[model samples]
Target: MKATRLNLAPWLFLAPFLGIFCLFTVWPLLRSFILALQQTYGPGTTEWVGLHNFRYLLTDPLFWTAAANTGRFTLGSLFVQLPIALGLALLLNRPGLRGRGFFRLTFFAPSLVGLPFVAMLFAPILEKRTGLINATLHRLFPIWDPEFAWMQEYVMSSLILAALWMYAGFNMVYFLAALQNVSKDLIEAAEIDGANAWQRFRHVTLPEIAPIAGFVTLLSVIGSFQMFELSYILLNNTAGPENRGLTIMMYLYQSGFVVGDLGYASAIGWVLALTLMGIALFQRWAARRYEER
Candidate 1:
């Protein structure tokens, strides 16, 4: 009886969490999967479609456009944004740097601002003629075009730049923490072996912080893939000219909410979920291989 009661006690403690998880997470996921297999006409109208939605998604041109744009953004975030973030973190992590706290705060401040606010702020800044970016460039270089169309032509570039501004600092925090945790002994030993600054970083600092770097990369990928609000708001709730700024999540939103095709949206959501899971699995496998090396 005592052993049974002890087991029951643990379950009793877990009951609230399990109930909440089922109600909110598990149930919603199951329902979404079911909904993905059905065609919805309205709030209450649905017809069994089986694999039809997934089949249609494969041939959808708009979906492919969104996928391409999203892939570009993800690549930009992984390569450009992450490198800059690590550089900033390295700079800030230096010992005896003046006003380190102030610099850190300044760099991280943009992340604290809400996405909507950041979108609003950068929208006018990236504008032509009267915009901050073009105006400054034109002022500095007389030959520069002040009327350059950033929002229209360079939609992905504009989105990538804005994301860099907002997220670079946030990602820097993770790198900074990882840097701090890196062993000074290993760094010093590498230096004693006549290794230069870059060599020491490559041999010691990088290996030490690799796990954190991988984590940040995963986070950036997921966030970039899920991008919607920033692009939507920056492009003024449209997909920009020629649908250049259209992202997967944005397409999902348009399908589910705007076009009243909840079934198709659910299908997109599952695709996204599966993609993320695959990426995560790949990362894990790669990490294991790297560690073995």
Candidate 2:
């Protein structure tokens, strides 16, 4: 009787959260998936059309381009952002770094500044005519006549740098937390023997925090795909000249809201959900394998 009561108490306590999740997340997902296979146009008119939307997606050039752009952004963040973040984490993790508190605040302040502020600040910095970047370049080098439109040609590069600036420190905070939990006694023992910094990191610290690192990687990938507000607000939703910043989310917005292709937009969203789930599962598998090894 006591065991039954205890089990029921937990479920009773969880009822509100479970009810909310089902009402919001689960219901919307299932509804969207159903809508993806049906033509959703003109009020009260939904025609069931299986595979047609998928066929359209397979043949769409812009869909392919958007996928490519998203992939590039994800990869670019991994390449640039992860390394810089990890480096900062390492530097901060060191035994005696001067003014650590001040540096931590300065580094993380950019991320805390929020998207609206970042966009407002960077819009002026990257404006082709009067941008600070071009101004400095022209002042330093007479041959550097950047008559080419920065918005058109350098949108991808500009967004990647912005993403790195906004996110790297946030990621560093995670790494810093992970590193601190590491067994200091083990690292000292490793140091006593002939292990160098890289050796200690690889053999001691890295393994200890492998799970956190893997989780952070998955987070970064997921976050990259969900990139929207920055480009939408800053680049004016065109991905800044030639749709170079047109992420999958932005594309979904264009289709669903701007163009009013509700059916096609739902299909895109369904695919995105599936993609995120797949990535998450794959990351889990990879992490499991790493642990096994």
Question: What RMSD does each model have against the real structure?
Answer: 1.6, 2.6
Any residue pairs clashing in model 1, and if so which? none
Stretches > 4 Å off in candidate 2: 1-16, 42-45, 141-143, 146-148
TM-scores, in order shown? Answer: 0.95, 0.90
Q: What is the lDDT of candidate 1?
A: 0.93
- Residues 1-293 of candidate 2 have per-residue lDDT tens digits of 99999989999999999999999989987888777887766435678898798899988888887888888889988889988988898899898789888888788879998876787778777777578877788878867764645556777677787888888999999989999999899999999999998999899999998898888889999998877776777786565666787888888888877777677889998788899999999999999999999
Task: Quote the positional error of residue 207 for candidate 2 in Å.
Answer: 2.2
Worst 10 residues of 2 by lDDT: 142-151
